[model samples]
Target chain A: MDTVISAEDLTKKFGDFTAVDRISFEVFQGEIFGFLGANGAGKTTAMKMLTGLLRPTSGQAQVAGFDVYRQPELIKQHIGYMSQRFSLYEDLTVRENIEFYGGIYGLTFKEIRRKIPQLLHELGLLEVERQLVKSLPLGWKQRLAFSIALIHEPRIVFLDEPTGGVDPITRRQFWETIYQSAAMGVTIFVTTHYMDEAEYCHRVSMMAQGKIAALGPPKQLKQAFQAQSMDEIFLSIARGAK
Target chain B: MRTIFFILRKEFRQIFRHRVMLPMIFLMPIIQLLILSNAADFEVRNIYLHVVDRDLSPASRRLIGQFAASRHFVLTQTSFSAELGFRDLEANDADLVLEIPADFEKKLLRENEASLHLNVNAINATKAGLGQAYASAIIRDFNNNLRMEWLDMPDRQNPGRFDITHSFWFNPDLNYKAFMVPGILVMLVTLVGLFLAGINVVKEKEIGTIEQINVTPIHKSQFIVGKLLPFWIIANIELGMGLAFGKLVFHIPIAGSLWVVFGFAAIYLLVVLGMGLLISTVTETQQQSMFIAYFVLVVFIMMSGLFTPIESMPGWAQKVTWFNPIAYFVDVMRMVLLKGSGWYEIRQHVYAMLAMALAINTLAVLNYRKVGA
Candidate 1:
């Protein structure tokens, strides 16, 4: 397996408070990696460092074969990002949002035009492609945001609580899309609070107090912790830190 | 470059699609040019006057007629009692009260001098000062006429006198509208820069769209340029329309080359755009941006010599005007429009504004961080 993302004791500190401690991890290409942590456990901060949106205070990291410290802009060209919030332009229509992102990422107008029909069809937004994004349902907007993040065909897509505030059925459907993207050779590095969803990840890493308490597949982690569910494993790890 | 074009298209689409922006763009310059230009006129006129004619003589009547004949003062009341005229002044019914004593004409013929008591309202200091000046001029004219009629004083009055006649240049009428409309263009462009480029960028930060944009391959300068170019163009168009309106409506003279005015304005707007860019990069919310913009704008406008002459301000305040961005443009507007000044005359201001643009825009670009601090 080819490793696409590698970190060596990546850390970030804001003033006196340490948001992400000296910790390390790796993700193979075309694999689903779940980054699990409780609220304020530094999941979002760690993700920011990896996506070139923040500078690490200490240690080193590499994204898409580019140094996080030296080549963040080059790293930007190879990676896609989605945040917890709805980040698409609310005033812009569905198609304009796609074209805008595609254009900024250096896609030709002909390429964007060819990609729109299939992209909209896959997101089930073909009917409302011309409507303002604010007018779309929340589920549609989320899906469209995810698709727009992948508009440039990035090698690794960072999903930060992408399925947050989504209903259970929609969350499952969103995972199917994530699984499909991974199957097509896109590395999925996602952070979520949903423990059951972590069970679906090929490998899961549980963070507690800015440190990774456990790192393994869900089945192995469940057996190693003697827990029946991934939720129990997270609860035991969080308790052990205290 | 291509990315900037995309962002520019997006910005223009968003600006055009905004419901309030269209109206604000259309009505702001028009309303500012119409209402503010007319409202900001400081020339005092139509003063209400009440008179007490106790003498009831030809001289006293002639004095009253002189006051009435002048366009500045309106004769509101004329009575035999000085107390009645004072009451009118006290009741706010009259701006000034003139009381002629019973021996006013008798003393003038006997002693060649008679004192006329005048009461003036000083509530509005400018109006009061100007009104007093106009009244004194009329009185001085009446005194000169009275002396000219005295045949006995001919040898005394025959002494050589230095006569001074002054004529106003550029705008000979000294029309306030001609001056105000050009100043109004400065104000209009400033508002567009502050609210559009400044507030608009902060709004993206407020709505979390900037987070998405930051992660893209777009460069920081590209984003700032995209935000600035659209509003910069819009402000210039508004200025052009405002200048045309000034010519058509207020008949303000455009004595200098339009190219010089626009050239100075083009550079001046970079200073303003840099300010807006700096403001947006430092602030995170539209409200905070607005507060800062208002704070800067109020001080800059007040110190800009827009409403009052900068020379009239205290020494420290006049020194402060050197740093005020709007002051340079206000002076440029008046200089180019009213004085028919060419580039050589306004070159110093252009150099100052260019230095300001370089310093401010460099600061803005430096302050803008695509990554988190």
Candidate 2:
């Protein structure tokens, strides 16, 4: 399979501190790649570099066959992103938010009209299309945000802790959407703190203090650490002093 | 361009949906236009005068009547003693005092020259000077009449032999309301456009929606254009309403083309909205944005000659007014509305406003950070 994302010695620094140390990784097409880290473990910084939102201070990264530094605009056109926070406009209705994001991706009005029904139906959001996003529950907003992110049908979707404050059942449902997208030959590069959700990925890279501490499938990571579960494997690897 | 349109539509929808901001956006300008136009007058009229006529003579009475007959002064109170008139001045009930000598026209007849005591309150010294000048003119006219009566001539046009005629071009009547209404309209546009646009983006930053846009495929210029266009339209609508009120309610004349006023308003709105975007780019919170905007606006409005004449300001201050877009717009509106100035007369001001708009927008876009990090 072709590599959808490849970062060669990716690094980022802010003034005196290194937020993302030199690290390299690859994500194949249609693979759900989980980036697991603690609060300040540089997961967000790395993902930002990949999405062309921030320039890497050193080394290089490519997404959808475009250099991150030189071709950031072209890279942006083929990728979708959802932040950890509720990023949809609360005052706008669900359908309006979809239309806005779709428009930003350069989708024509006719294309947006064609995509809205299918997107809404898949997210189970057709009934609440007219409601303000603020009035919806957190779980539903998360789903809506994800749906909006994928409005342009990009090749890769970068989700930074997409299910941070959601409930367990809603999180399970959200993963179902992620899995469904991955099955359709779209790569998923997700960052999360939840170990159970990390287990759902095809491969995982656990980061600690701006460095990649471990990288493998969930079961392989567990076996390599001689642990019972992915949770123990994460704690054992992350607990050691940097 | 298409992305900008989308953003603009979203912003407009949000502004329209918010019930509280809608009234504030429309009503505040109208109310300010009504109150400020009335309050912000340069022509001093109906000045309260306290008179102490100890002489109780016909000459003194006639002199006092001259002041009263002139529409500028009203004899609010009269006292037999100077001490009583001073008391009234202290109480703020009177603005000026005219004290007549007790000799009862004896000095004028004997010496052929007499002087009356004129005491004026110095607080709000500008108004006091005007009041004193008006009183002095009245006394001079009375003296001239007395000289004519004593000579028993048909006309005493021997010595001075000069006629001075003054004419105001734009505002023939020199109505202060006519001068201020258009300037106040410009101020309202600047205040609303800059403050709301600055605070709106800062609110998004505080709420984290700005981060969402920062990471998206949306270009920074597109975002900036989208953010400012709604405010641009709203500001123009406000200009229209203010012009209508000025014409119908205040009886202000619109001597120039309405298109000229609107064209200037359109360019001026961009300058102010760009200023707001610059403020938003530097400030982190909505409160900080508003406070900074207020500080900048106060300076701009003061220097814009909204209340005082720009030409009367110090030379350095007058030079600074050239850069203030509010000054250009105010001057343009007043010239167009009152003077009937055409494109040639106001072309410099129009070009200056356009340059300011372009410069401010360029600076704002340059200062704007495309990436959050």
Candidate 3:
């Protein structure tokens, strides 16, 4: 397997508060690597470092063979990010939003024109392509945002609570989309609090209080903890931290 | 370059798609400019005056006639007692009271001069000052008329008279609309450009779309340029509309080259747009940016010499105007439109604006790093 992301003792501090401590992890290409943590467990900060949105206070990280400290711009070109807040322009039409992102990533006009129809078809949004994004339901908007993130065909896609506040059926479709992308050899580094979602990942890393407490496949973690389910394993880890 | 174009297209689409945006940007400001040009007039007329003529002589009667003859003062009441005339002023029935002394004609003949008591209501200081000036000017004219009547007498001592009449140059008619429309146009353009650009970036922060853009490979300069061009274009279009209204409706002359005026506007808008971006740097939401921009803009517009003359301001306030870009534009617009000032006359302003544009835009771009990206 190919290692697409590698971090060693990456840390971020805001004054005396450590948002993300000296943490180390490696995400391989074409695998669903779940980053599980409770709220304020430093998952978002760690992901920000990997996505090149933030600089580490200490230590190092390599995203798609580009150094986080030295070549954050190049790293940005190789990774796609979907933040938790549904990052599509609400006032713009769905097609315009996709075109905007495509242009930002330096896609040619001909390429953008060709990709729009196919993207809309994949998301089953061809009927509402011209509708304003604000008029769309939350689930459809989230899906469209995700599809736009992949327009550049980046090697790795970072999903930070991508399914938050989405309906359960759309959440299933969202997971199906993630699975399809992973099947096509695109690495998925996702952060979620749902233990059931963690069980679906090839491997999961649980963080507590700015530090990773456990790292392994869910079944292995469950067996090691002598727990019946991934939820119990996460509870035991969180309880041990407290 | 094509990337900037796409961003521009998206921005334009979003701005026009808002249902209230077209009217708010184009219609409302134009309406306000039309109304304010007529409403914010400096021409003060029809000041109410009360007359107290104790002499009851031909001199006093003719003096009262002169006050009634002029266009500025309206003789609202006539009384014999000074106390009665002052009571009219107190009741707000009169703006001023003019009292001729009982020995008015005798004093002028023996002493070559006579004094009259003129009391003015000092509330609403501008109107009071203007009303007092009008009264003094009429009195001065009456004194000259009496002096001319004495010159008609053969056996009279002819004194040398040095009379000064102010001929208002450039605007000979002293047209209030002509003086103010250009300044009002500058204010409207500043308001549109400043608020639109200021609110735009902070709105992205509030909605969290900035994070998505930060992860893209878009360069900082490219992003800044993309954000700037749309509002710049829209503001220019609004300027064109306002200029048309000023010319067609108000008949305000454009004495200098239109291109020269637009040339200054092009650079001045950079400073204003930079101010908008800078406001976004310290603010977290659209509401905070609005409050800060308005607070800053009120200070800027007041010192911009819109209605009041900057030359008359105090020393410290005048010094503050050196750092104000709106003051420069206000001065430029008036100089170009009213005085036929061309590029050579306004070159120093262009240089100053270029320096400000470079400084402010650099600071704004440096501060706007997607929250320290």
Candidate 4:
């Protein structure tokens, strides 16, 4: 498998405090890679570094085969980012949001017009395309945000706690969209607090205090720890830290 | 460029969706322009006067008659003594007191140099000054007629030869409304641009939408440009409406080219919008941004030489106004609309506005953060 993202000794600091310590990891193409951590455990900092939104204190990172430091714009062009706070314009309709994001990615009007219906249908948002985003349900808004992020057909999609505060049924539906994207050869890099969601990932990395304490496929990690499920394994590691 | 267009479209949508803000943004300025123009006139009218004529002579009566004949002043009451006139003034019933001493006609005939004491209320100095000038002119004319009758010479020293032809060059009548309408227009546009733009991005921060945009591939400069463009357009539209009202309703002449006024307005809008962006960048909440913007705008408007001449201010205050962009635009607008000044006459103000625009915009762009700090 081709490595889509590579980070070596990545660190980020604000003032004298380090947020993301010397961390290294790799994400391959077409796999659902899960990033799990407690709040303020440096998951956001690491994701920011990989997405080229932030500069690392002293590290080397490459995304989509482009250097994060010297080629951030190139990396930006190839990856999609959906933030924890849904980024869609609340005052605009779904179609307008799609066109806006597509335009920002340098997509032509003809291309955007052709892709709008198919994209809306795929996300099950065709009926509400004319409604303002603010009027939509939170679950629907999250789904629409994800769809807008991928409107440019980016190679790797980053979902930063995309399903936080969403109901289980909606989260399952959201994961189904992610699965569909992954099946279409799009790599998914997601962060979540839910251990059940981690089970769906091809591999999972649990961060503890700015360092990756555990990294393996969910099944392998469960067997290695002799746990019944990913949830039990996460509980054992969290208790060990305490 | 396409990104900027999208951002601008979204901004317009947001502005339209909010019901209360929409009327304030579009309708308030027009209403103020209509109502305040009439209230702001500097030409004093229906000025109440109290006359204390002790002489009881025909000449004294004629002098009082002259005051009554003038359209600007009205002889509202006749007092028996100066004390009564003072009482009238204290009661706010009279603005001026004309005191005629006893034996005034006899003294004038004998000495040809008899004087009349005139007391004027000096509070609200502008009205006081105008009243004094009008009363002095009437008294002088009455004296001239008395001199003519006493001398009995048809061709005595010619008053025409000594006349000072003081002509108001641009505004021939010195219409105060003509001057104020343009100035108030500048105030309205600057207030809207600075306050609205100031709170816009900060409101997003308070609501947590800023974080979403920060992570997008959109460049920082692009975002800043997009945010300010809608406000810039709105300000210009307001300017156009103000100019139209000035010409049609007030009959204030557009002495200079309309295009010249638009060009200066466009450059000045950038400076004001940059101030808004800078305020948004520093503030975290909408209310804080509004308060800060209001404070800065109050200082700018007062110091902009709109209500009062900058030259009349103390030297230090005048020096401070040199840094105010609104001062330059107000001067430019008045010069263009009233004085009929061309580009050559207004080049200095134009250059000053451009420089302020460039400096503030560069500072705003530099201070704007694309990612969370």
Candidate 3, position A209, lDDT: 88
- What digit string (tens of lDDT, one per residue) describes model 4 on residues B279-311? 999999999999999999899889999988899
Residue B97 CA displacement from its true place in model 3, Å:
2.1
Per residue, candidate 2 scores C-alpha lDDT tens digits across A1-242 of 99989998899999999999998999999999999988788999999898887889999889999998888878888998899877899999999999999998899999999999998998888999999999999999999999888889999999989998978999999999999999999899999989999889999999998989999999998888998988897787778734
Full-model lDDT for every candidate:
0.90, 0.89, 0.90, 0.88
Candidate 3, DockQ to 2 decimals?
0.71
lDDT of 4 by residue, A1-242 (tens): 99999999999999998898898999999999999887888999999888877878888999999998888778888998998876887878898888878877778879989989998998788998998999999999999889887888888999999999989999999999999999998999999989999999999998878888889999999989999988887777776656
Query: TM-score for chain A of every candidate model?
Result: 0.98, 0.98, 0.98, 0.97
Question: Which sections of candidate 2 miss by over 4 Å?
Answer: B65-71, B74-91, B148-154, B157-163
DockQ of 4: 0.39
Tens-place lDDT digits, model 3, residues B238-282:
888998999999999888888998999999999999999999887
Residue-level lDDT for A128 in candidate 3 = 96
lDDT of model 4 at position B137:
95
* Candidate 1 Cα misplacement greater than 4 A, ranges: A239-242, B52-54, B77-93, B150-157, B160-162
Model 3 misplaced regions, further than 4 Å: B56-58, B84-93, B105-112, B147-151, B154-159, B371-373
The model with the greater DockQ, 2 or 4, is: 2
- Residue-level error in angstroms, candidate 4, position A122: 1.2
Q: Give the TM-score (vs. native) of candidate 2.
A: 0.94
Candidate 3 lDDT by residue in tens digits, A1-242: 89999999999998899988899999999999999988888999899988888888998899999999989999999999998987999899899999999999999999999999999999999999999899999999889988888999999999998888877788889899999999999999999877778988999999988998889998899888898998997887788778
